[model samples]
Target: MAKLLMDLTPLSYSPALRRIWLGGIFSTVGYSITGVAISLEIYALTSSAAAVGAVGLVALVPLVLGGLYGGVIADTYDRRKVALAATLSMWVLTALMAAHSWLNIHSVWVLYALIAAESLFQPINQAARGAIIPRLVKPRLLPAANTLMMSVGTLGMSLGPILGGVLVATLGYQLTYSINVLAMTVGIWALYRLPAMKPEGTAEQPRRGGLSSIAEGLRFVRGNQVVGMSFLVDLLGMFFAQARPIIPALAALSFGGGEIGAGFLLAAGPIGALTGIAFSGFLKDLSRQGRFLTLSYAGWGLGFTAFGLIAWVFDGQGQGASVRESLLRLSLAGLALAFMGWADALGGVYRSTIIQTAAPDHIRGRMQGLFIITVVGGPQLGTAGVGFAAEAMGAPLTAVMGGALVIITIALATVRVPALWRYVPEPVPDTRQIPSV
Candidate 1:
């Protein structure tokens, strides 16, 4: 275990890794702000939970479309260029959002339209960013590197909501949008500093638009039971079990706290994630990655269940609770959320490591693209499903039921899909000897 973790230390400061991390940090911060900006915008305009969910639905289509096509693009182009182009598009979108806010367009559909356009490029950005990591650090450090990435991402995710609220409350939406633009500039600069990267797999010679490459990636995933199962677990857990979109409802209605309270609840998960990353060094030596993954999934579901039940208890008190009572309930909810964050982060590292270590270099980009789809798709599916369930059954019930389902599903998956449990970590190759260019 100690040896596995030590591998991360050396790679942490490798020049290429440093460059990528710096850029990723900036971009992540901007992404963090997006939810707050969009939600507040919708809430201010319509004050409807369903309306806010529409923002996610709008982005969902483009995200899926981009992830599918983006893989082909990544496989076909210079990776740096692919990333650069996506970053540029994001920059344009941010600027446009700022302009729309400043002009007081107040057109809800307009915001959705721009977000949808931006989402199309996001998959490419994510795939390119992920694909670049292994090249930057050795395989042994992959888990650690991913942990670092998650740490930065969680920090950004945490900060985005908090800051977005403050920015919206103080500077207004235009200013908040402006800050996202600035963050994009910083992201672009970081990407600029990175050296050009070539795809690892056989560069599929672009031949009159064929499905062979896509089939090949699918075939690769299918052939590897571990990777296949990892993807499915993550997708299912996130899509069906995630309860994040319900926080606002809990805060506003169930818990008697409003927007600020909701932000705190949303931030709680990332806080747990940050904590998990802090101890990521310990994960390096654990050969029982599969076991860790299954446990993490189960843990995540359990946490959500706890949170939902707590919300139900608070709701049952029937709306006249004291300020202190409300605060206590919210605090407990945050704690439960924090647990969910940690579980998800741990599982994420396990699954990602499996994908990176198992896939051949030539097809890594394509696999990553598929991975991006599952990654984004699961949450979007969750957003839609959770939103509907919450609307129909109410937040507390929705959360509790969702949580219970996730736990059961993961537990059943482990027993039924023994492949996930029996999996072992592959030997981390020593890449120190790979001569620098």
Candidate 2:
């Protein structure tokens, strides 16, 4: 048991990583606080589930653009600087959001704009941070390191929103946003302490930046079948399996428990993810990453399908269902979400490990940037898609149908992309060697 626990040596191995991880936890907590606040505020203002879903649509384009260009910038300049700049931008935006709420700015459009601004910088911040991990830890410990990051992140995701819900309910939006501002400062401090992270070897020159750099990154992904397939699988899973945006509506209209219930629903998956990561010492030795990834997605689909079924059977538009029955249904729904979260976190550990281990350091930033886009953008797109579908067919039906689609798509991808199934991390070649462009 001690030996298994010690697999997470990366946390103790690198002070830089430790600082980054701690800072990320604080930042994520703040983000979660603001995230719940904004969603609830938007829902309250518009009284429309579609309006809450539109938040995802508002931020998606800027996030995509930031991710692509942010990769180019990270490749061309000091990544630490780029990341710090982006983090600072987010910090400032959080303060602005707080101010907006504190002063009673009632325009939903202003809220949307603030969210968009934050989204623009988020990918840049994430891309640099993602690329920095491989440099911080040894190659042999990459999986453990990834698991540790996921575990901490899952911890934040689990606790933050629950805390957010309570804080927002009692303290209101202004104070919740202010709390986020303070939390963000921890991330900024961590970035400030990091060593400079200039690109390895010949960095891309400013003149060879922008579209040229993006094209090079795309070319690399295109040529790597395993990496390409990993991204594809993740994209499909997120696109179909994301059902978070409807939690508020589900809580109020289906479960009869309102905001607190929504928070529990939101927190359920991360709770499961945290639990999975606690036992993830075995993952470091796993070689059949492709198979594990496929199984994880399948698990996510199954769990989501179960959640939908529970809602369909027990919830009747929050009408006539007794309080006891509603609570029971909510508990079952949370259990299903927890199962899905565990599966998703398992898949994330492998996906990140494969990407960090396989991609060479020279273009790792660009690849990580693309990875950030897929991670961030896919869910937003999913939210928009699922939200629209829910508007048409209701959240319960949407989840069932969407989860089914994820299972079918992943199955097809596995059968079609045999290379992905057979993928194993190759030994890291000389760091000085760059792939031919």
Q: Which model scores highest in TM-score?
A: 2
Q: Lowest summed lDDT over 10 consecutive residues: which window, candidate 2?
A: 428-437
Superposed model 1: Cα runs more than 4 Å off: 1-12, 201-210, 316-325, 432-437
Range of the 10 consecutive residues with the lowest summed lDDT in candidate 1: 428-437
Q: What RMSD does model 1 have?
A: 3.3
**Clashing pairs in model 2, backbone N/Cα/C closer than 3 A:** none
Can you give the lDDT of residue 162 in candidate 1? Answer: 71
lDDT of 2 at 134: 81
TM-score of each: 0.92, 0.94
lDDT of each: 0.76, 0.83
**Residue pairs with backbone atoms closer than 3 Å in model 1 (clashes):** 1-285, 200-361, 200-362, 201-361, 201-362
Candidate 2: tens digits of C-alpha lDDT, residues 344-380: 9988998887777666776788888899889889988
TM-score of 2: 0.94
| TM-score between model 1 and native | 0.92
Q: Residue 276's C-alpha lDDT in candidate 1?
A: 77
